[model samples]
Target: MAVSTLNVQKCHGKNIEGWSMSITNLQAWLQEEGTVVLGISGTRKYVDSVTMKWLIAVLYFQAENPNAALSFYWEPLKKAVRVEGHVEKLSASESDEYFHSRPILSQIGAVVSEQSKPIVSRDVFIERRAMLLEQYGDGSEQLPRPKHWGGYLVVPEVIEFWQGQTDRLHDRIRFRRPKSGDEPDGVLLHQGDNGWVYERLSP
Candidate 1:
């Protein structure tokens, strides 16, 4: 997606140096422009299962909070729409197909590692690894995709973008609404050049 630059005068008590934009706003704009399935690139930190679970809980809290910025009906907008659900497991055939397509090392690692579970000793893990190696012998054939590993689809109900400026004049934009028409056909984009783009803000 092409990013459009918006000039701002001031943001966050700083002078606007140059044009800036908000990622959330940009996403909202794109949705309005009839684009879906945006790909975002970021670092993937290895989060333990507990951390992941906690993160989900926090999201749920914000999602359920009535006064949060990300809340769906906050007049001034509080939070992004939260889509929650269990990870769907792939069918046996689907799992087999995906496993064969994965890198051999990944397959082996998945087979050997006790995901989302505690391992007491490195030696025990190594022993399990050696045992799997002996059994699989290089993982060339399709090894079943782990049952714990699956997928979840998050449908973003709102997307906002903000761009930082030199003097703290950041650009902010938001996209959201009744997602009714066909895909990529009825998305709406709202552009906000100044901080006062949307009305109804209290002093």
Candidate 2:
């Protein structure tokens, strides 16, 4: 397993950096702890006045980069899944249930870290964590979920599957909602189950 660092600049000036983990661990972490930093809180004030359209894309690697000192000449074979969707915030009750379901230490950690705000040093988190531990001395009590901390459900609009080939001829199949009068032509577009259509793309 290889450790990779991901740095991303989020909307509203929030940033994630120095996060290193194996691909599998990172994927799991993003589904769990990463949700805490999702930008719903920073834009809450503007939400009332503006139309909010929450969109999200999730990418997964099936066959990853080969482990080698030099891989430039290696076959570009790969497989991946890409999901694009609209997001809907979970209800307050749902969020609360999920938050409390976590381990006590994780709950406290969520409360201590100030999401993406820049910090002066590691001492900031250390001090904050120490203080929180002292306040919640015993693990019997559940920490209240912060207003900004919650969950979202992604309603997939388009899902794409990709496979890379050594001959430089990759394959891509995209599934999406079908338009009115849309019919599968077989060669490029094909009819899929449940009101969906799939089309292949040129590599």
Candidate 3:
């Protein structure tokens, strides 16, 4: 999953800020200056790398051990889903609610580590975790959520489904918001629900 900060304009293109976080059953990270590429498949080439704070984000899901051969020497199909979207920062109250719901140890980890910053050694985290554990180990004490910590919501504008084929003519289907002057002729582009459009692309 890709996430970007809201309200901070023009982060350095190379530096992306993020930290590992687990909520409920999902684990994700935040990227400060993430890049999102547009125009996956079509005649019009849009090869620009868009680096913006809130304009782009992607959620990618890939299969595990897809390259390995299956039973009877059959090759397994490699599949992935990519979603690109606009990012919106969650409200402070919402952030607080999610923060407090985390396990105590996870909460401590978030507070102990300063993401994208340099530290002399891993022992820094070990020591800090130990100290915090001693202080807030009991249920009586609660670790306060850091003001800088929060969450983001990625509203998808485009989504692509990909499947690898043995002939290398892999299948790709993209669903996205209809751009201005888009007309589905029912062959190359098909009209979809809620002002969306779908198209099959050449691999």
**Most TM-score-accurate candidate:** 3
- For model 2, how does the per-residue alpha-carbon lDDT over 51-91 read when each residue is reduced to its tens digit? 11111211111011111110111225477655454444556
Writing each residue's lDDT as its tens digit, candidate 1 over 1-203 gives: 22222223345777453433312311221222222211111101112211121123322212222111211223254323322122122234644555556566666676666544566877877887677667666555445555543321223334455444566554555444433442333233333332112211111
TM-score of 2: 0.62
Clashes of 3: 1
Residue 36, candidate 1: C-alpha displacement in angstroms: 13
Write down the worst ten-residue block by lDDT for model 1: 37-46
**TM-score for all predictions?**
0.42, 0.62, 0.63
Rank list by lDDT: 3, 2, 1
Which numbered prediction scores highest in lDDT against the true structure?
A: 3
By lDDT, the better pick of 1 and 3 is: 3
In candidate 3, which residue pairs get closer than 3 Å at backbone N, Cα or C atoms, i.e. clash?
Answer: 17-32
lDDT of 3: 0.52
lDDT of each: 0.36, 0.49, 0.52
Summed backbone clashes in each candidate are 30, 0, 1
Error at 23, model 3, angstroms? 19
Which is the better candidate, 1 or 2, if ranked by TM-score?
A: 2
